[model samples]
Target: MNALTPQPSHLAMVPFVSVANMLKIVNRIGPAQMIAGIAAYLEDDFRRWEQFDKTPRIPAHSRDGVIELMPTSDGEIYGFKYVNGHPANMARGYQTVTAFGVLSRVENGYPVLLTEMTVLTALRTAATSALAAKHLAPQGATTMAMIGNGAQCEFQALAFQKVLGIDTVRLYDLDPAATAKAVRNLAGSGLTVVACASAEEAITGAQIITTCTADKQNATVLTDNMVGAGVHINGIGGDCPGKTELHRDILLRSDIFVEYAPQTRIEGEIQALDPDHPVTELWKVITGQAEGRRDARQITLFDSVGFAIEDFSALRYLRNQLSDPGEYIELDLLADPDDPRDLFGMVQRARP
Candidate 1:
């Protein structure tokens, strides 16, 4: 450890992965492989869903966007993520979504890992989508229509390709440049990338359709008329109240699966339905407690409003990746004293 890096002898140092180091990790592992790795952890956690304490995310809503804290824990470990969604940020030359997260031991309440999650969140979100599709998408689904080609477009495309053997991604965005950007990024991804003129064109032969626009309203990115039978729709952009992508009729016709029912009922596409609208939690399907896809003709929708467990799994993956110490730098974020009661004295003694 560098001398300038905090090393309080009394405290357990937290390993922090900065944005640059996170990029290194991703570049080292490759995005598709990282998504697959995180998906494995997600599946592991979901299979043990009964062991976790779950709740809705706490959000602070503003006129421009929303910020939220998603938290969850098993008996042995705890984790949380600080995330925000601001649709206008893209126009302002900033990220529409940004986040950071931490994972800590339940026994001592000391964080073992702290990492920048903006990039990690993107990877995990893609992994979760792919995991859901692996269970719910049409069998042998080889093509996907990506309706919004923004920050998450290529990740979704690549994930579906990596996880579902999707060979073609048809891209469309209200802004044509977004589609062009996706086409550019996915050039060497080994999947067939086709830039389409419209949403209808994008879904031409797609068995799976993923709508991930960044608008912060009840925009009908996908109307009922557009969605065909037997198509698996993945809606990820409707992550807050009053914001949705798919039409209510589409949700009514599709067998909707969600991360957490309570949170999804408030912030997912299902929010457009009645309070008593029935849905299945994805964990049940992962754990074999509930059915995923009953037939090839069933329209399955993963109304992904992202849950805390996925973040916990991602943070856990990051923490476990510590076989390489250089992947993160240590930070003295906690104030532990030789004597538990001498926190102030410990601070005063570090005057140099």
Candidate 2:
């Protein structure tokens, strides 16, 4: 190499986990175990939640979908995810959500890892819900009512099973095909799976109700009359402005928990309530700074809006797993010049 041109080295490459590699990693670790690992990272970070730089995701809304960038930093490392939500995409044979993420060194502002996040987001979202339920749900709760059987349904089912010892899942969706898909996917997963005709039927005898429908409107997937006392609700789907899954009356009666108050108020089911509505911070509960469930009869709701720190935690977990060479490829993403000032010379040398 010339004095002005440095040879490529590990420092000049970024670890990239493609969708295929992600699948291989999931298969190697197993989905439920991978989710549990992510949950462990999430819990550790949330316990020290005060250390993170948190902000509401930046979103650009369109008639068809919304694209968002969720970013956060824990002083030493920075992470962000690029995600899009397009409910209509499923009708055209595409996923409703897709995402990719980057984890970087804060000191040098250089990317350390890049990975597909569409599957990782689902895993972390489910893990976060299960972690919240571990704190807020009634102790020894075994059954969950999964009220939407979309891409997130099976992940939610497995997370609850792995994290909270949930043994049964009752599934319901507006589309019978979606419910059927969940039934097919969860077959022989060691949990009793029941496909129900309606949301009401799904909630029958269930202690945890998880609503994850993908709609861009204020849709009441769960009504106050339908939810009984002593149940924990995981509100997962209504995660943007003008979107919600629970009735306002249910919010008025439940002890609501949220990730970050400012962002959840704008993007969660709590958006239906007053801006200053009383809600518990989940990190406080995890850290024992606040109480979770006061009584079995008290209904608890986790208004999950999918925060950036959760994505950061997920990226951190994925980056840690990159020690397995089979799970990733190195990308020639950065330029390394022997002379720091010879950027043009470095470019000219590549013209061969």
Model number with the top TM-score: 2
TM-scores of the candidates in the order shown: 0.97, 0.97
**Per-residue lDDT of 1-352 in model 1, one digit per residue for the tens?**
5565435763657889999999999999999999999999999999999999999999999999999999899989999999999998989999999999999889989888899999999999999999999999999899999999999999898899999999999999999988988999999999999999999999999999999998988999888889888999999899999989988899889999999999999999998899898899999998889999998788999999999999999999878776677788889788878788987887776666
lDDT tens per residue, model 2, 262-287: 99999998888889999999999999
**Cα lDDT computed for each candidate against the true fold:** 0.92, 0.94
**TM-score of candidate 2 to 2 decimals:** 0.97
Candidate 2: count the clashes.
0
